[model samples]
Target chain A: MQTNISVDLGGTNVRCALVDENGTILSIVKGSSNPEKGAQAIVDKIESLIKQLDNYEQANAIGIVVPGLIDQEKGIITAANNLPKLIDYPLKKQLEQDLGKPVILANDVKAAAYGEAISGAGKEHAIVYYISISTGIGGAAVIDQKLLSGFHGFAGEVGNVIVDPHYEAIGIMNAGAAEALGSGTAIIRIGKEKLGQQIEHAGNVFDLAKQNQKEAQEIVEQMTDHLSTLLSTIALVIDPSIIILGGGVMKGKDVFLEALDQKFHAKIFDAMRDIRIEEAQLEEPGIVGAAMLAQQSVSH
Target chain B: MQTNISVDLGGTNVRCALVDENGTILSIVKGSSNPEKGAQAIVDKIESLIKQLDNYEQANAIGIVVPGLIDQEKGIITAANNLPKLIDYPLKKQLEQDLGKPVILANDVKAAAYGEAISGAGKEHAIVYYISISTGIGGAAVIDQKLLSGFHGFAGEVGNVIVDPHYEAIGIMNAGAAEALGSGTAIIRIGKEKLGQQIEHAGNVFDLAKQNQKEAQEIVEQMTDHLSTLLSTIALVIDPSIIILGGGVMKGKDVFLEALDQKFHAKIFDAMRDIRIEEAQLEEPGIVGAAMLAQQSVSH
Candidate 1:
């Protein structure tokens, strides 16, 4: 239940906060990140954010989560697609040295999963599988309140899992990857293609579907089916007690969450149908989860 | 390096062995099982086989592995398609009460995975993923030499994973599950349908492919592709250091294993291309792995 400092670094901004055991954000600061300026600049901005925080000296440790893969053993960001310039950067060492405190680095999505497993919808569960359905889908698992990061930090990399072998992805991922089929980016792209109009985002497509737009509804249904398949595939691998769905796309949960859960249950084996599918309940899970990561590292 | 007793109960036979810490089979026995007679009969068969082993009283513990889903917490067989009447049967308590020894029960495939991780093909690795491609396709994982049996014991149920959502399965599995497409049964079924001839088994299909029969080769290629997809899917979830391919289907490894490995690498991320795909090395991994599982429970 100790207070910890957390920094959630993403493409748009670097969000810093003082999160306690209850996942409460006591104080927060946000700074725009020009990742194009390289890792040092990002580090400077983080220090500035820390300087702006109240009671920063009282925090136990600092945890930073980047939106990409990390070589956890070395505490380096191995890949950050949105922050392309920072790949292979040693973020943990720099932060711990600069801030003069223990530092823990993790993937943003994985941090959120830990937050959910400990303080949100999955708090009561021993095994929680979390999927973030945003601009791109990502997933991670928290087992017995510990993040199960694999040797190469590729554990719970569900985004690249193929749901359909026949469909080809435009990028390095497999054709019909869940990220390519069910993510907000995919929904937006499919919406514009099918509706023959500029669909603003995944929410707009859902709105169109709510208004009885056939094409938009079909697109949403397809995404739901693909996501269900992705969920079942995850169940096939590790049948966690609960699966939490989070991310920006969850804003439209009312439109498809129930149906998506149903489809998922229908697809899995009868015994596994008991696995719960729930929405993530934490407001700022990423920052809070990063704080938990700090707590874990400090205690360990 | 204690010697433990292991019972690997499959449909055709109940194999028992005294396995040492190094996965060496010091003594062994196999008994034909009349699974149709029910759960009690199977337990009696196991006891009779154990009686046949030399120096049985010297073993540290006993481990039983069934080729189906087990309710680990309750030590009961939840489901076993091959041994249908044994579902919901408490095999562990029964064996413990009868033999006056601590009994550990596990899925046969998972036991094999643990066997590989500790002393078989994947002995040198910390994380090992094992897939059995026989009449059906099944998978299991051993992480840090510990079997990661999920809450529902469905941690490695890869057979039901859908590879092609568009294809329909003849049974309860998803339309295009890996088992439905890549398994030995699938090869025989596809071969018979496409070749307009009686296909004895998976090996015959491979033999035809080796003889330059275009249709048979196509079937083999398609099965290999499905299995590759299955392997990539496993890597996407838990990027294990080594993946061990086992089961009856591996008998045709000379024909398709190299190509299947290549296809699997081709489908995964560049960073993960280092994951080794190899064949199972142990002569009887299931019995050996069960002994390992028994050792784990006893030590813990």
Candidate 2:
């Protein structure tokens, strides 16, 4: 019945919680991370947030989940846009010193995938693939409740998977990357092209599409095709039992879910047509999955 | 020094081999399989080929690799065009009863991937992805010496992954499938359209391209671009340590390997730029991999 400390480290905020074996948050604390200040400051904030939790001392291990390329074996964040200073930072060693506890570090999307595989929509399946479509795209695969951390810890980085050969490049990803064609950021950017000075967020695009706007619908249809292609590519390679979709993009999914599913079914190979794509069920999968990682790390 | 019985069931022939623990073929036999004669006849030929092997009886177990959608768990060949009658045939159980030994069945591509993973180019790596570009395209992923049999045992069926939106459909696969644009079959079809006559094989197109023929080079370039997209998509999802390429297409690899590598590098994500793409090292990976599967089944 050992408890665990889980930390969800994001650019905007950090949430620290004491979690039980059942993955329930016993005592939680949240604070602004302001990672732009530097990696050391973020570590200080995480430490201060952990102190605010009542059962912090009882936690046997800690798991930190962050967005970036994490060198899990060495417990370092190699590259992160939000926490740019985290590049090559020994966050695990630094936090372990301040907390006096063993720590496990993993990619945020991978942690959430583990959470879903263990106790969420994918609990009954042997393999689970998770995709998060938000301002940025993220993905992870969980096999038998263990995350598939590929060599170099870069497996399931599907956001950069190209789905269209005709799309424009965005950020560090190449042209036609799923993130460039299907992500919320992509939707907002394209929506602005259709409705200049009127479109705001992805929601505005979806709202117009829901109201039967032709230009908005066309953009959404293209997004659906891109997402379908990405998922179809994933289906061909991994053929997971289930694929769970989450992130801010899911908020507007109602407008395109049916069409997306149809497009996916149309493109997927007959042998792989059965993979179920569902919404992620956990409220705080990143936090809970991190605790799951900490709990599982006891054996590792 | 336990030996294993390995059988490679192909469209026109059956190859049976007595393989040692190190995957060395000690005794080999080959015979016609005339799959058109149906599943029972094909199995009978395989049994005959096994009997011809000098160490057949001494082999502890047997593995049969076939070109089809195999139900590894249920020991059935659920679907196959080469051996059409194998659909839903109890291949493993029937063969086990006929040969008086435990039997293992797997897709030919997956078996070859296991072969490569265990004793070939992938021996030193934790994750190996194998792709065979022949008349058709086939692929498989081996993680930690185990084949990643997806939910439906259809994982690594990358031929059907769409890489273009403008290309016409070639078969059951959707428009723009990798097989439709990059396979040997596809090359022959497109070559005919350019040459205004019959083309024998993919090598002809490559030969013309090597001579700096404009029409031939255009087709080859398109093929390279399609392959690059497919590989880039795979890198984003699986992020394997290395990818092994084989099949008849590799026979002309010298002509296009450099261009393919360049296109892949240009499109692949920066984080995954290090994953190596190499040629398959084993001369007969299908036969060797079947033996490996047989040896692995004993432990299972």
Candidate 3:
């Protein structure tokens, strides 16, 4: 019966909601986070946004999900480009004091994974791995409805996973990182090279490929192979009951989903070829999962 | 207060031991399993070995660890190349009935990971990942002492994980599998081609490298770089507190461990640079882990 106020905090906007046990948002308020206004102002804006929730007072705890790395054990945002000024700030402690309630902070992807594992596509499975392919790629594993919080809250940072040691090297990331080779950013980058045009978005590449453009189709196939290698490698390591795919890349799922599945199965041992990869079912998994994470943490 | 019988069943030998609460081997016996003599013969051999233990009747349960795939949920050995005849046998039920105790079967790498996490090099860590570089590479992740058993029992089959989509291809494994690139078999394979000699063992290559053989050193470096890529990729996926290395390849640890660590750190994000890689500290992790698994399962 526990209820929670979940906030999906991103650079551009933040959504505060009151969530019930079934991951339904009971009441919600949304507004620009304006992280550029600096730490204290953004924090105050979040507090006001929470107060605007129709059933805010009924919430048992607050859970804020962020898009960047968090020093979870220390209750600080270690690195976030949008909220740079808040980096290393005692966000958890500061928010808890102002709200007068227990608070939980989780990585956005991890929270989404937890949400899906408990109430969405992964509800029937005990081991669920969630992968998000957007401008960049990220992932999280939810085992028995609990997120795999790595030693430093890096358990699901699969975007940086190296797919090949010899292929391509980008700044900071090693050559052939999954994010470098298969993410939305990678699609656009590869698209420009092959099509000799300013390909603005990954969707365009998918559309072109769907329209039977040989160049775009090659890029899509390249991305598919890169993802297949990454997924197959992760599957070997963790062996999730199911892997749920979400993110901007899923917009192109119709173009690449079947190919991705076939390529993934071809890479792993036959016994593991059955590990299902499906599109995420929740429309607002980040907020819902944040709420579930708070509810679970407080109840336990 | 619980005690159990742990059996490390390999194609070559079987070691049975009475394990006490602290993972101590109270009593032990070892001999060839003679798997070729057939499934029933091996089963009989195991039962006889258990009987040879000083306190066989005191065990509350039995845990057997095998090298190949298992249908852990069904308690069946699904595929073990060495014991081909026992592929679909009801090994767990047969053993339980014969020994009159509850039985649990686990993959060897997974059991070794449990052993290390429970009482060996990884005892102090909550998330322990074990990677063994033997004839082929295998790995397992033990989070809070429980192995991450995949949908089937293929969770720790890292050897078959493809490292690159375009590297050299082998039999059933996809092109550029971790085993094909970095295992002892790979080392010997690469050494033979470069040094123009039948390199009998990976250790000989390491020995020659130590003696300043240029071709051998290059092979060692190649293997080291492949391992670094593999480990760095894995670190991003799971972010374990500690990674314990075992298997026959560790015999050449002096030649490659330091370089492997340096290369591994170089490839990962700065935040994960501190993750430790250490040699496994168990003389017999297979038997010890199998025992701990039985003890934990029954108590739960």
Residue lDDT tens for model 1, A113-224: 9999899999899889998999888888787788877767888888888898778676777888888889998998888888867787898899999998998889878988
The candidates' interface RMSDs, in order, read: 0.9, 1.2, 1.3
| 1 against 2, candidate with superior TM-score | 2
Please give the ranking of all candidate structures by DockQ, highest first, separated by commas. 1, 3, 2
Cα lDDT of model 3 by residue, A236-278, tens digit: 8888879999998899999999999998888877767678999
Tell me the DockQ of each model, to 2 decimals.
0.77, 0.76, 0.77
* Candidate 2 colliding pairs: none
TM-score: which candidate is best?
A: 3
- Pairs of residues at least 3 apart in sequence or in different chains that clash in candidate 3: none
Deviation of model 1 at B172, angstroms: 0.7
Candidate 2 ranges with C-alpha deviation above 4 Å: A34-41, B36-41
Query: Where is the poorest 10-residue window by lDDT in model 3 chain A?
Result: A164-173
Q: Candidate 1: where is the Cα deviation over 4 Å?
A: A34-38, A52-54, A81-85, B32-45, B51-54, B81-87
- Which CAPRI quality tier does the interface of model 2 achieve? medium
Give lDDT tens digits, candidate 2, residues B63-100: 88888778888898877778877778888889888888
Clashes of 2: 0
